[model samples]
Target chain A: MLSKNTVKFIKTLHQKKYRNLEQKFFVEGEKSVLELLNSDFEVELLLVTERFFEQHQKQLNHLRAELLIVTQKQLESVGQFQSNDSALAVAKMKSNQYFENTQEDLVIALDDVRDPGNLGTIIRIADWYGIKHLLFSSQTAEFYNPKVIQASMGSFTRVKFYYGDLKEIFKKWDCPIYGAYLGGSNIHQLNKPKPGILLMGNESNGISEELAGFVTNKITIPGFGSAESLNVAIATAILCDNFKRLAGE
Target chain B: MLSKNTVKFIKTLHQKKYRNLEQKFFVEGEKSVLELLNSDFEVELLLVTERFFEQHQKQLNHLRAELLIVTQKQLESVGQFQSNDSALAVAKMKSNQYFENTQEDLVIALDDVRDPGNLGTIIRIADWYGIKHLLFSSQTAEFYNPKVIQASMGSFTRVKFYYGDLKEIFKKWDCPIYGAYLGGSNIHQLNKPKPGILLMGNESNGISEELAGFVTNKITIPGFGSAESLNVAIATAILCDNFKRLAGE
Candidate 1:
């Protein structure tokens, strides 16, 4: 059974303002929803199709959240996915999260990554690289945006994002800053110091001029071809790979 | 001055059928349009606003293509972008083009990469890595799709795409095949041999079981954290970097 108010409220969560106000965000599809259920994120509501309920009743029997049987059509009305079969859960947002600066930990900070997809991909890259802490400028894409959540593909649950001004974080941080730049020394050649801030910049613009000044090392991925720039997410992944590879050595 | 027929025709180009049927594709926005103008691609029509014509008259004066002055409204109705400022070009498609595999060059092959954005990013990555030849399984996303073009960010002009069965290409190729996989050997320690196939797989299912048989070298971008998998494009970029780095040595 679906209530009109509940349906309307979930729709509002699709917007960032409603999500922030309610302190809740929706996780759609089975994989992400199941991951959410397994994680520390508190599930407030679970809506599953009849097929999904029948298949997962053993798992559902243990969860304490309010569960409702929903048709695919009903799921479409409340969220963006039109043919989601398994589940959609409204998960409580993690708040008051501060990335504790550790000198031995490698982390990434975004200057102004505006694309939700890029931010999400960055999160996944960070997770793959074992980078647990991600700090994004307030101007970066909202963490809870559905597009970002979808693109992260469940890595969002593992990676913690701390939103703050990069300038403030850099000023007080304990490690060296390696900002990605076009003119810097080749990243492949540089012996990247671990436990540093790998600061990436906006997609269209490189790191802001103000933030560039604070960077202790301006490093670049050497380009063999004529591409003007690598995509920010690609750049981040390569840099992370280099950092991790060097650490292993 | 968009004709009703022209508007209807441009709308059709948004779909693969119409694009194939007309043997043409639409390049949206000012930057891409300008790049198309400068490239070897033949422009069938250039739809530009009066403001754009006035600003780029020096650049536009020499073009042999038919030009029409259009309002931004005309562009939005006819193409995917909601508000394009400068120009849109209906460009002729390149046909019968094949990725020329060379014993002296590094190349990338895709198994079943489906997303337009992923394909676009891979093209950009290929361009950045100086991998001039790209082979894709027929199931891969088409290069001329507007989203792919937009996401490629003008790199479509530089990278050449060849669509075929991966099995066929691998059977006869002279070089070793390095396929990305989760269970593969650590990519860091291996001295990657040049002039080999760097094969990538589908976003979800990975390289199909049938195609996996052809891979000569199985490699992985090791994951230090809990991320189940990296986005295909990110994995591709990391692998390309490692290959390029080792080749340089």
Candidate 2:
């Protein structure tokens, strides 16, 4: 059974303001909750269906957080998904951290990436390609947005996301700044990609003109057919894959 | 003004059954509407805001379909999006066509890709990579789904999607079958990706065991970070990019 305050807190996590104020975010579904528990992220609370508690008794014993086992009906009231999963967790949001040296081999910077799903997918892609640090413009979707967290599928635990002014950050670095553009040089023809910041822009718009002017290299995924533009997330994956391939060779 | 029957008819398009029964789908937003007018797709009706008609009178002259200019309020009554765009188009669904001989150097076969957005993104990715044929299992999202169509961003106009049993189709193919899996050979290590079908599977459960047994080669995108899995759409793009890279090289 959920206390009135607990229910209120869980519901409040749906909004960015409340999530930030509390410095916590919710992870739903069995896989995400279990993964979060095993991660370095601090779990504030764990809510589980009574059936789940019975089924995963051994795993639950390892958790250090406060646990509450409730009926399915109780779980459904606080669940975001249509079908309530067995477990839900509220974890403390990690502070934004940047590496000491700043200049690294392949960091990704997102400029005004508005879609939470896109942001999450990009983070997952970044993890796949081994790109460690992800820098985001202040206007990008919050890292704790429920949709972003859900789309990440636990990648958030591995990838570091820092939100700040991209222009200010890029100015501090003396490395190559690659920006993905529509009519730019074909990405395949580019030489080896070194340690630098690979910048991706918003969904509807490519890199902003101000940022585009500062970019050291403008690359594009050459299109053979007509698509208004690739989805920002898809574009990021392709670009990251290309960067990895070039670096490997 | 939208008639009672017209409003009812437009609303029905939201459902797959009604869409199939009518053999039509809706495309909203200015970009999609303009693309439909330019494509070979038959536009059954064009609902335009009076402001849009006045703004683009020159371009409207070339349209062969019946154009009904309505007030913004009337457009909202029949529009699917949150805020109604200037124009909405009702396009006759293209018949699912299968080629006797798979002529495309590369094709994509999706096995029960449930998300409409993922399916649409895959179609757009296929289009971008110049893969003309996209074969879908019977369980895959319908290509004519409005969300899929909208997400494709006009790429659906060029990519031919066939809905059928993938197992039957693979048995007939003379080319290599590349199935994306987790522990398979690293995709980057493959020297050549021959003209073949790249099979992507369900979001949660990967390629069904039945399909996995039939694959000639299993490939995995090597991951270095803690992400459990890549989004289906992102995975497809990475695979397609790699395929293009190897084939073109």
Candidate 3:
């Protein structure tokens, strides 16, 4: 059974303000919670149903966090999930200090991408392509938002996130910066582009005019149809796939 | 001002049962409502803000439907969006009967892709790649769901949706059927897949066991990182991008 104070604290983390204040976020659902437990993230508290506990008893024994066997109803009430019968784990947020030093060949960056779901999906895409570092403009959605955490699946654990001014960071970087644009050169026609950062922009707007100068190469996923645009996350994955595939060639 | 009876009737269309019974669904937000008006679908009624009315007055004048200039607050109250200052249209659902005759070079099918948001995003993706027709398993989320409408942006107007059993439909599909899976041929390495149907599966589950036999080529987006899987919609777009890119080659 979870303490009343603990339950109250967990609920507070749902908001961005509270999550920042506490430096913690919760991962809900069976897959995410199980992934969290197996990850290097420091779990502070875990609320799990009896069935979840029984199913992973050996895994539970190794956890250093406070573990409470709670009802699925309690978890559903405390977390954002409509139905979560497995586990919910509150874990400490990793400090953003170390991600700046990343020397990854292909870095994924978001400029004013404000949707948490999109951010999470991008994180999963970054993970899938083995892109370790993600840079976000200050205006991007909070990485710790429960929506992002849930949408990221378990990939959040593998990807490192850094929130900073994209312009300032790009100014100091020496590598080629590929910016996704509406009428840029066709992505498929790019000839052996060098490794660097891939920047995606806001939902409604493309990359900001200020960041446009920093883009060494403006690329586009040439459309064969009449749809106005692809979703940001979908665009990100396609770009990542192309970059990785070209590099391997 | 909307009549009390009309407001009550519009509210009922939010649910699937009511939508089916009345053979009507509503499209909200400025972009979608404008697109809905521009499309060939039959609109029964439209609730618009005075500002929206003035901005698109010429477009609204051509509309054969009843138009009520309501306040933005009224539009918000009657719709699902947190803030909708534009318009909402109650339109008749197009019958699924005519879509079976589609002879497009490429077709997209959904096998129990049950999330309305995912379905909507896929619809937008389909529209982006110029895939005119989408076949859904009966278990897939309803195309008329409000979340689907909003997420598809305005592309919902361009794509035709058909819901039927996969096995039955594929039994007669003549072209190559590429199915997304965990492991198979690498999508990037495929020489040139002939234009055919691209089938995506449910969120958690891959392609259904019954439908696996129908797959002529099992292809996957080879991952360079440790993430488990991409979102279904994201996968669909990537596959569509690859297929179109390869075809153009």
Best by DockQ: 1
Clashes by residue pair, model 2: none
Q: Rank by DockQ, highest first.
A: 1, 3, 2
Candidate 2, superposed: residue stretches over 4 Å from native: A102-104
Which tens-of-lDDT digit does each residue in A1-249 have in candidate 1?
A: 789988998999999999999999999998888778878888899999999899888878889889999998888778888678788999889994786787777889999999999998999889888889888988999988988888888889998778987898888886889999998988878774767899999999979998988999999999988778999999999999998888874
List, residue by residue over B1-249, the lDDT tens digit for candidate 2. Answer: 567888789889989999999998998877778777888899988899987898889878988777888777777778767777598888899888887546557788899999999998898888887788888999999888888888888888887778998889888878888899998888888887678888999998989988987899999987766676888889998888887777674
Better of 1 and 2 by DockQ: 1
lDDT (10s digit) by residue, model 2, range A1-249: 579999988999989999889899999877777778778999989999878888888888888888998766667788687777588889999987765435656889999999998898888888777777889998899999988887887777777778887888788878899998888888878887777888999877778877887799988997776675798889888888788777783
Could you give the CAPRI-style class of model 3?
high
Q: Pick the candidate with the highest TM-score.
A: 3
DockQ of 2: 0.77
Show the lowest summed lDDT stretch of 10 residues, model 2 chain A: A96-105
lDDT of model 3, residue B13:
93
If ranked by lDDT, best first, what sequence of candidates would result? 3, 1, 2
iRMS of each prediction in angstroms? 0.6, 1.4, 0.7
lDDT of 1 by residue, B1-249 (tens): 678988888888999998899999989988788778878899999999999999989889889988999988888878888789788999999884665568877788898899999998999898888888899899999999999998787888887777877787787777888899999988888875766888899999999999888888999988998889998999999999998888883
> Please, what are the lDDT tens digits per residue for candidate 3 over residues A31-112?
8888888889999999999999999999999999999999989999899999989999999999875355345579998999
Each model's DockQ score? 0.89, 0.77, 0.88
